[model samples]
Target: MNTRKILYQFGYRRCADQDRPSPARHPVIVVGAGPVGLCTAIDLAQRGVSVVLLDDADRIGEGSRGICYAKRTLEILDRLGVAKPCLEKGVTWKLGKVFQRDDQLYAFDLLPEDGHKMPAFINLQQYYLEHALVERAAELPHLDIRWRNKVIGLKRRNDGVTLTVETPEGSYDLDADWVVAADGARSALRGMLGLDFRGEVFEDRFLIADVKMKGDFPPERWFWFDPPFHDGRSALLHKQPDDVWRIDLQLGPDADAKAEQAPERVIPRIRQMLGHDAFTLEWVSVYTFQCRRLERFAHGRVVFAGDAAHQVSPFGARGANSGIQDAENLAWKLALVIRGEAPESLIETYDAERSAAADENIGHSTRSTDFIAPRSAQELRFRDAVLALARHAPFAKRMVNSGRLSMPSTYETPLSTPDADEWSGSVRLGAPLPDAPMRNGHDQTVWLLEALDGEETLIHVPNGGTPPAGRRVLVIGHDLIDQDGFFARRFDATPGSTYLIRPDQHLAARWRHTTPEAIERASRRLKGLDGEHA
Candidate 1:
């Protein structure tokens, strides 16, 4: 646990639950205070669910891990009221460059379009993101975040679960109606449940050198395959906040992990890469990654999220972003289930959708890893040829993989109502709604996600028609004023076009010309109240 800066620390406090005759049963119990766990607790607490968040560590700062936060993650953070601090502190970038040796083969824009609030991604230390979530959690009275409270043991029952939590003094028991396992990849809960977390385990290793240097390198993601400085190995460079730069150098499968992380070995590599010794080593570690996950995310009353449910190469930047999405998808459905508004089967969608998402991420990460570290001579030659061809051939640019960047997952589940009418739009029925700038009722310009704001909203361009009953409808010309025609063009919207957006900002259904009855049916179907969605 080497950290350049200690950002957050909390003292251990004895709770009254330890002395209760019967274990205090909470509506929801969240394990691990990492980004995923904190988000799960905050989102549920905001939905008015009583949550108890437990973490083994007394402080947040560790090595600067998982620095790349995607734009979709920031939008989810915005809904939790904590995206401002992250955006303010993190380094923003959308442009990424791919290189073959010393030559730049290609560059890509993650967010080519405009009118979005957040950038393509931000390189912020993991501790900063955790600190922001912890600060936001303190504002919620119902959310109880306990430091040094670790779930040492768990017992699943028919009604719920009883957990044995270990603290400084001793141990205590807790009963929870539902549990969220967001602990890291080495999860204690996953082991306790007898679930297998086996998948692709990469043999090659990489060394992370976090150096503090006052350099003028523009904030962008730069990846090199067979770079001249790293001896025919891959390397990545990213600029972070506070003049800290993150460098990743590929070490072969047989490299000594312990020796490679030492300052004696790491400093020379850094000097060679930068051609200067002015930078001070802030933090260093060697890691071997994998693309693995459990068979399913949901197991009875306990649901797994984050690294606990899935593991992927950090180069893809899918680990933390997908975990945040897990919190969003599970929180809304779990809230509905706990409130008796939706059947217990709603939880099934969480497993189905997130498991599919995990598979997609694992697939991409595996391919990226294979391409970056070719296993055979033929594979190496193919990868090199692709990199060389990418300089001119547009199709070859698609073949070159320097880690396919993180993107939001589009769920293909029964919950989404398939498009009934032939329409021309980039957005799909189950995909997330593309953001656009619009004017609210107060005549203030806001992002479309902000206007949706954690509610099941109906965006209707009025044709002198009223929307469905029992749903919040935002009239395009009235409540939402679309200027520059970005929203209209993106959604293929017309005067009578209608869309049903879920609470998580995903499109549930849409139509060319729809009635109130159809919208109501789609709403029910989205909630698992009707159709095969249940």
Candidate 2:
């Protein structure tokens, strides 16, 4: 059996030529081919918008970074046509255990209810997730992913943006009607624009090691606060695909990152945790936590998403998940603006919605970071007291923030129309459409989300007649059976309730009974259009 680690590389193709005639202007140019950029490009392409994706690297992420993916991210991936492979290759876990100094404090389950299509969380190597996105992007003809193409300079023009991309052959100029910077946290594009990212950088550092080991440890997240093996520090263990485990150990602010990553120092720590079990170290990295975001995600014709827009501590797995959501939110809006279906003012809402999401992620990440790494002795004592009480006290259990974990951010923006009639369920305006099992006209089981199919739709529960002209209506009872009553219950649907859903699957508005005129008004408002023309 081979112990060597296999790294997959997506070979680079030279698409930019300095010697050729002036390049054609693309509708959209997405910087960075990471998950966010790839997803954004694929989404726009699927919406019939041609996109050019540029990345400096020819390969996916090297290590098992960002192992935990939330259900919302999975749902977004489902629409991108890569969720099936991701679900198959990922480790799904909902239970998490927290400990204090070798004693079990409490354990909790993330998803206590059912009826949803996806699980609460899945642990998958970032590389695998990126591979899936890349494969999906390749299937779309309108998406051109050019690897090893670095953007060295950018200028926001009146009508579009011009980017100077450096390829292996030579540097060439590329112009785009709009630019999306989904590059990583150290975004060159962000720097080129002379923008500043503001927030706090925690003094603590953490060592992340991915080890291949055959162990009896169950597939769950285990967090230890000051375990006996590594005194006075916290450790986290998460199971990933391919029998590899991700271990994150907290090292104080002053610890030497280089020395901590040395095999001699890391091997002994692993030996203590696993009790001399046989394991091979696959990857190791030391990182500091920072909760930061740009003041605005959209800057003129150039927009930002993923780490380029906001960055948070790794504790909550918010970084990648939030970035994916950012891509999901911006892709449809950009497509609409590019196609003239919506006004360019709709693009400003992207800044409004995603910047709020960035703030939410940053806040959660900061709190989780503070809980895990208390700033003072009094704070540490308070954390320990909460952990101790969590062992038996129900109230204390809720206070334990090993990491609040990632959840989808609901937008309270001008786009989402407030509920016109009273509703009973948790799915509200500005929320992602909840998933429920149903049987389509073909009499085969299907998910309500699958029926959405990335289109702006109006779902009329218990069957309503044809909607207004140009509106796509999916009558629940006529087109699909609400199997198990899940759809009705989850959506709080009354007999005549009609739901208006956006192309990104977010709930735009709902009413007990509405007219075509009302629906059209709400739809137009959702696109940032005004007045009688709307």
Best by TM-score: 1
* Model 2 clashes, total count: 0
TM-score of each: 0.98, 0.96
Q: Write the per-residue lDDT of candidate 1 for residues 1-534, one digit (tens) a residue.
A: 244766779999999999998899998999999999999999999999999999998997767889999988999999999999999999999999988889998888899988788889999999999999999999999899899998999999988999999999899999999999999899999999999886988899899978999887789899998888998899999999989999999998999999888788998999998989999988899999989999989888999999999999987799999999999999999898899888888899999999999999999999998999998899899998888788889999999999999999998998788676777757887888888899887889888898898888999887876654567988887888998787888899987888999989999998888877788788888888886442
C-alpha root-mean-square deviation, each candidate: 1.5, 2.1
Evaluated at residue 533, the lDDT of candidate 2 is 72
- Top candidate by lDDT: 1
List of clashing residue pairs for candidate 1: none
**Each candidate: how many clashes?**
0, 0
Q: Which stretches of candidate 1 lie over 4 Å from their true place?
A: 1-5, 531-534
Residue-level lDDT of model 2, residues 320-353, one tens digit each, is 9999999999999999999999988898889999
